[model samples]
Target: MDIRIGMLGFGFMGKTHAYAVENLKYFYKNLPFTARITALCTAHKDTSCAACAEYGFDRACGSEDEIISDPDIDAVDVCTPNIFHYETVKKILRAKKHVMCEKPLAVTYEEAAELARLADEAGVTTQIVFNNRYMAPVLRAKQLIDSGRLGDIIGFRSAYLHNSCMDPNKPAGWKQTGEYGGGVLRDLGSHAIDLVYYLCGDFERVSGKSLIYYRERAGMDGAVWKTTADEAFYITAQLKSGAIGTIEANKLTVGVNDDLSIFVHGTRGSLRFSLMDPNFLEFYDGSLPGGDYGGDRGVTRIECVNRYPEPGGVFPGVKAPVGWLRGHVGNMYNFCSAVYEGRQAAPSFFDGARISAVIDAAERSDRADGAFVAVAQP
Candidate 1:
């Protein structure tokens, strides 16, 4: 089967998705379906045309409507801004086409939930871009946790930090403003929250605090502008299993580049993973014997570099170091395979909605001055 895709937006993530789709054949052997971006759509026709010519897309479209209405497009890949996701996804779902959406499904939980509903009604394969979940080490962590190696998750700490917001002189993009539904929590926190939720469990309640250290920054146009989004967000959440954890998402931290780390502790064992050090997962087997010299009780670093199962790990030889882009490739492969196999994707629209619920609860807690807010069940 050829899964012809109509892609919306051509920004960083859009290019990333294109790379993943174009490279899937090299990463996964014997892929059941071939997928490609058949059409490209952007806010401007000229930009879209240029991207199509440069990136080998079949055609360029001026608006999303053309892509959504095209019968030849079997799937729609949405890499647009946070603000446009809700409406664009709604149309694609209505068209009964498969969808692959980026993180924080929508600006609000209500919108995310609505998209989830439409996705279900459409009966089309859907996936949310929680790319971190597809990493080799992260996947290994999930396996251990599911096998009860982590026992009952007692606590966890996850954080995604960047240095983008540290300099006040830097020009603010759409991500630093509420007008485009951009906030550190929604941008980075969603990934952190999803990681914990994916490894640990569903959140029961949460308390959150937001910080905007630099209230003013230069806008994209070089004019002085007041920031309306949180530069940093902190959340204390309890899972339904009674495990409590803290999640931090900030862009103001200095000297960090795409640093996302997570530690989960349980009664039987513990797990640690850092995006900066993506090739290995640190695991402590509590069941191991402990001698006077600490014996085998110490943490063991499991090398998970490109160690994906059969069909995968074939091109890269499984020993090659895995990087951030590998996760995107894995995510795209999963979505395409699920669509081909007539199955639901793992991180489906429902997962996106659930994560949005957690974000919604955290935001409400922030508004209430860090009071505990119950996460709405999706």
Candidate 2:
């Protein structure tokens, strides 16, 4: 049975999610159940129409409530903006429909927590899209950690840097305004935090430095504007497992896919994953006998595996079809599976809320000049 889907918000993430859900059947014929974009939502009819036409959504609506309230929508996929996540999800849950929302589930920990409670009461499954967890190298890293190959993790470092907002003249978008819940920390830091939790377990505390490198930038109306949001973050965390790690994210890097890569070391071994080369993972085993004569550690490639309705030539993470939605594709697949089978997937609302709290804690630490703050639960 094809799971009918209604997509909310049709911008970058919306388009991406639409692409994933639409082509899901092509990638995995045996998907526990199929999914189709039965409807779409955007803030305006023109935008919604354009997106529906471009993305092949069966129908489009200008308002979120309209789409969520529609009986035809089996599940609501919220992709509007960070600010809308909490409320839209609330309505969807109250309507007794599953929800698949983007990361950093809510603007604040309090909001996230409340939504989680409501979802439980609504008896519906909810998932936050932490797509990076589906990436090949990252997934392999998780497997190694789960297998205890990287024993007694001693230290770790990771960062997601990019040049998207480097231009001081770049006009403000929803991402640059605090009211819209825009900022590098919550906008991009959520992925990094979730990646850390997925591979290293829970964290005890976080200390951070968040900077708005551009105090002012051109506004949407071509006027200079003061910025209230962070452009980058430098964070340090101490995991509950006794491992120390650093995570950084920036949208103003001069030129690069800087956001890719995490280097990890343990008392016994080490691991490395880079988004630049999404296909490979490096590993080192200190206990491997007679390794002194050879190299201490080496890199291994993780072929892009996928699940099966395969357009059959080559696709990323082909080994796991669900992983195909990694960036958004695998994420959508997981969300659909959760909706269809009544299964709760990874990075649930509680998880998203927790990560938001972590970011909030980091931001608080940043304001206090890098004070170490406890990473409280949501």
Candidate 3:
């Protein structure tokens, strides 16, 4: 099978997705289908054409409509901004094409729920880009939890932090504006939320607080502008299983670069993972007997670097230190494999909608002065 993709937007994420598609063969051995970006579209025709020429796409589309209407394109990859997701993904579903979308599904829960409904009705393979879930350590974490290694998750604390918002002189892009559905909650919080949901379970209630440290910042054109988005967000949530946890997503932290970390404590054992230390997953098994000198009782570092199951871990060797890009590659590969096998992808639109619901509840809680709000089910 040959899966020709029509990719929307040519920004940083666009380039990342393209790299994932182009490098799939090298990372995964014996792929059942070949996939490539056949058509590219962006906000500007010139930029699209230039990207096509430079990246070897077959054609440059004047608009997303051209990509959606094309007959040869089997799937549409939505790498556009958060504000564009609802409309663009709706059209892709209407066209009966498979879709791979970036995080946070949409700006609002209503839109995300509708998208989830449409995706289910369309009966086409769809995937949300929760790339962190594809990391070997994350995958291992899921396995251990599923195997009851961590019995009855009691609590968890997760954080995704960055230093981009620390400087007041920095220009405010779409990410700092409310017009584009940009905020720390939607940008970094979505990943943190999804990981907890994936590992722990469904959320029951949440209390949230949003902070905007820099009310004003330089605009894209170097003009003074008021920041309309939250620079940091904090959430205290309770899962349906009675497990409670705290999630913190912020861009204002000092001396941090993609410092996403999570600690889950359960009755039997606990799990810890950090993006900065991506090569290993720390696991503490309480079931082990403890004696003097801490006999076989402590955190065990499981080397997960590039140690993917069969078909993967073929290229770059299994011992190679896994980087951030590897997660994207694995995510892309999973989506392609699902499409090739005529199966629903993991982290589907429903999962995205669920996460959207959690974010919606968090935002509501924030508006109510950090009052607890129930997470609505889609």
Which pairs, if any, clash in model 3?
Answer: none
Candidate 2 TM-score, C-alpha based: 0.79
**Per-residue alpha-carbon lDDT of model 1 for 1-378, expressed as tens digits?**
999999999999999999999999989999999999999998899999999999889999988999999999999999999999999999999899999999889999999999999998999999999999989999999999999998999999999999999988888888998899999999999999999999999999999999999999998787899999999999999999999999999999999999999999999999999999989999999999999888778899999988899888786776568665668779999999999999999988999999999999999999999999999984
The true-versus-predicted C-alpha distance at residue 117 of model 2, in Å, is: 1.7
Runs in model 3 deviating more than 4 A are: 323-378
lDDT of 1 at 316: 74
Per-residue C-alpha lDDT of model 2 across residues 1-378, encoded as one tens digit per residue:
767888888788987887778666554445687788888878888888888787667887877887888887788888888998988888899899988999889999999999989988998778999888776568778778788888888888888888877887978898878889999999888887887888888999999999988898987676999987899999999999889999998898886965567888887778888777665678777666545756544544445444212443244434544333456857788899998999888888888898899999999999999989988864
Candidate 1 collision pairs: none
Clashes (backbone N, CA, C under 3 Å), per candidate, total 0, 19, 0
Residue-level lDDT of model 3, residues 82-150, one tens digit each, is 999999999999999999999889999999999999999999999999999988899999999999999
